[model samples]
Target: MKQATAKVSHRLRGAQGGMEGRFRLVLVVVMAGVTLFVLGRGLFEAPDAPDTFVNGTSTSPGGHRALLHLLDEEGFTVTSSVDRLDVLNENDFQDPEAALALLEPSPQFLDKYESEVRGLFSRSWRPPLILVLPKRHYHALQSDEDGTLVLQEGIYSIDDSERVLQLAGLGSELGVRRVTGGDVIEPDSPYATRIHDESDEAQVLEFTSAASPWRKLITDSRNRTLAAVNPLTRVVVLAEPDLISNRFLDQGDSAALARHVFEASQCRHLVVDEALHGMATRASLEYLAVRPPALWALLSVLLLLALFAWREATVLRTQPAEVDARRSREFVIEGVARLMLRAKDFRMAAQHLQQRAPLALLPSRAHVHAAGVAGSTSASLPGEVAERLHQLPENDGSEEHLIRVARRVAEIRREVSLSHHVPSARKPG
Candidate 1:
């Protein structure tokens, strides 16, 4: 009956162990599935497009959104486009309103839209026009002799370059060699503000290149003064497009500087040369774009993660230390004796002896030694202390001698305490 009951208990224990093993297996499988799903999603998902526009709107930079927000805040309706005729028809060429025109570098926009652009200034009733010309498309516009592209009699161009259209000398010289490579415009130049890369100073401005016939109206060391204001139209020409781009909106006092130009001109209409839009978009997109990570770097990270998981699953148990009975007592006695010798403090040694060997009477031996009674050596100290001094205990002699030294030190202390005035006699010669 007892054997049958024991067998039943063993069977129950086996069943419980099997259930625990299956539970652990299920947990591991679930974790593995989750990891695979996450990794697969990261690998399959498409990359995000570059953030060219701020707040996800406004085609060109120059705080276009902020500018629109500002206008809306001030109760003004803001409109945008590349067509000059639409601008004129909206305002009926009669009401004086402010308009800003953004231009691209397209040949069709420059060649076909010339007549419409001219008609904007034909009527006496016109709005103020703000022109944005980037270096890439500056050469597409037609200009007259003296290197000046005059929009009206009062408004004209001042500077021109082969690489980028110079608008009032706002950018670095085209084809100028840099130590690191590429022509870099100086960021500190009055005409050029908010330089993007110091290594390659590609100036983003509203001016055209020399290939185009845009004329120059102003020239100075700091900035090329272009197009004198028509006193009536209040037209203003800016050299760098970055003056209004989102990236430069907060750079180098650009926001305040642009605001000053706008408020100072008092023009209701802004004419953007659509030819410069492509260049500006390309530049802005390039600034915001980031390079993808290398494949080797990704693989290395995955490999390290796999190695850690494998180590966790296959960890080994460390063995416990073995006990040695024979060496244990010898180790303790040797350790104590070495400490006493190193310290050279006999009083501390005596205290240690009393604590370790309570069965040995060391106090009686110390009293006999202090009395200076000859032939009373048998009772001069404890048997343990005497056996140690004479080295009579064979393998245990070292421990005995250590105890004897401690007893003698205690006796010397007693003698010094007992005699207050008498100088202690020296050991016999």
Candidate 2:
């Protein structure tokens, strides 16, 4: 008994060992899946740049984003507008203390949308408008490693300075000429802060023309006007946007000078025009959508989520009921027949048939009459059935005899069923 018990325990331990191996395989597969996920995330994440001219982005070393940040720090609400002038109204520029700035807008943008500028001037409540002319042309290049595009910059005068001036409604009155001299500023002016450019003498942006109806604000060492204002239109033009540009902002009190620019506006709110910067446009949206890696990542996430939901639903669904284990009467009959045939027990099979059918078919009519308790003296169909079965020729353990006896029994049953109706069927409705 003890040996048998030990054998059973060993088998149980074997089964447990197989289950443990399977569990380890499952754990290894899960760890491999997680590793792949982390690798994919590292390979596909987007690059983040600290400096970009894009509105609402942080001031970087290469862009004029610092002005926006400075204005925000001074407690003035700064709003960036992406829509065109046609969609904007007086309410957009209606703050009691509001100033508007157009930063390095391209000449092409000004020429194509001249009517929008005119619309702003047409309004009754005229707010101060500042125009910072474009000075550099940067080309965007694709990075080889990540296939991301970065801007490659080149400095030059705008392609069409005259066209831009005309669109701003200030024609040749405010001309632009490249300056070869050092930094030009008016430190004593209230609009000028104590911040001085590095060296107090670096190559800078200086104005070449300062015509009537426009007051000159700053002049270069050569005495050329660098910054001016048109009181009639409330427009301020800064020849060089360097003082506010991201790269020059952190050097030698440039931030202080930037604060002076905002303070000069005397407005409670500042508006930065981003429409000319190539953002919030249908073209940009289309461009991002076409990038292969971003699109692929989005599709992969959706597929994984769908699979997880399907698996969860499958696990939660109820299982089907177990099948019945006991055999039916027909199954028993067929099983017994097969057993008898295999054993070549013809006599026993014949005996089984007689005992199984005759008893159920026979009735108790004769016994009831002997006890004087029957209303009808005729025997039931079962009694007649039993009598007919007894009259058939007996089987002699031969195949022919067995077949004949079985056929006679079937015929008797069929005749009795046809001649006698069931008691329930015979009752009047």
Candidate 3:
């Protein structure tokens, strides 16, 4: 019964300690899993910069992404690239069947990349280029409602538009002009069937004073050029970007006009130039660790580290180890002695040993002598043991007294062990 009780008590203590250990282990595992998952995602989740850029990947007002999606709806494949035009090959750009569309590109990009772009276009195997002049730019500012950004449209200079068109080798001045009487623009040149305008009154579009060698394909009222093409270079220029931008592409016949413009190019696929608007995509580990989303990734890693540090200092600290389950003989003796001291009844322990001493132990001399007296009992054995024990200085239950008592007990145990192991002598035959 005592052994069962000891086991139960040990088990209860073990259960409590196990629970705490398990909780810490599970917490560490879960936190590690979450940290790994967050790092993996943020490592590659680099978001594009300037949310309102005029690229096919954007959905903002100034972007012409709606036209690209419409082209998809009409069974045309669309892709985009942030790679510079000069370094592009068939792998990055595509074949002659693919058309490269530069929608509302920044004039600064054109001026800076003029030499490289001209070199690209000079390639005989180059894809048809569609250069759309910039219409409006935007400014991103923090809003009053939230810390999030809101894009505000700003006036776009016409000089920037004219600069890009001139770089395209079309010596023209780009400016906005409206029809004097009606919105009906008369198409006077070949390939005029591409016009899909449903508006009776021409909403004004930016036009270019394009002439000879630059065939005006589409025009606003008064025969002002809205779109034209250089036959030799296979480059098409659209002066009016609002006709295809996300904000106005849904207006009457605008979607149809966009489709016709792309379909007439005889290109199988469309590739929008995203490099001009600064959305370069690099998936290298170095780039991912230091790009747009790098801040968020760094913050997450720091938070995880902080949590780990806190756990080490507090929750994960080592607890004082529990005592060994199996008690040693020396340990049991010292433990009982300690209890006796605490109870202030050292006499109780002394009395216990005094009773058991003579009664339980064999006399020291009789230990081997019992073997000699085979069938006979030792009538003087008890008397001898009792005399010996009684002659010792009386135990006062003090620590020193207990020490002497322990030595006597040890001598008694040794004699009893010898008495049991010795061979008995034959009866006095």
RMSD for all candidates, in order, please.
22.8, 18.9, 16.9
Candidate lDDT values, in order: 0.43, 0.60, 0.66
Better of 1 and 2 by TM-score: 2
Each candidate's clash count:
57, 4, 2
**Highest lDDT against the true fold, candidate:** 3
Ten-residue stretch with the least lDDT total in model 1: 175-184
TM-score of each: 0.31, 0.48, 0.49
Residue 162 error for model 2, in Å? 3.5
lDDT tens digits by residue: candidate 1, 177-252: 1121122222343443434454633332233355533333332223443222333445555444444555566665
Off by over 4 Å in 3: 1-49, 92-94, 144-149, 172-211, 281-429
Report the lDDT tens digits of candidate 2 across residue range 1-429.
856866676677678767865775676567557645655654564433222343345343446667777778889898887667556545667777778877777554565567876676566655798777666545557876888656776654444554556676666466676645454455465333222344432223333354477776565545566566766767777766666777777765567656655665667687777766654232333234435666577567657755664564465533322122124566778998888788886777676676666554443456445555546334465566566667767768877666766786788667655553234223336
Superposed by TM-score, candidate 1 places the C-alpha of residue 298 at a distance from the truth, in angstroms, of 51
Q: Model 2: what TM-score?
A: 0.48
The parts of candidate 1 lying over 4 Å away from their true place are 1-63, 70-76, 81-87, 90-94, 100-108, 121-125, 136-193, 196-233, 268-429
What lDDT is reached at residue 279 by model 3?
A: 60
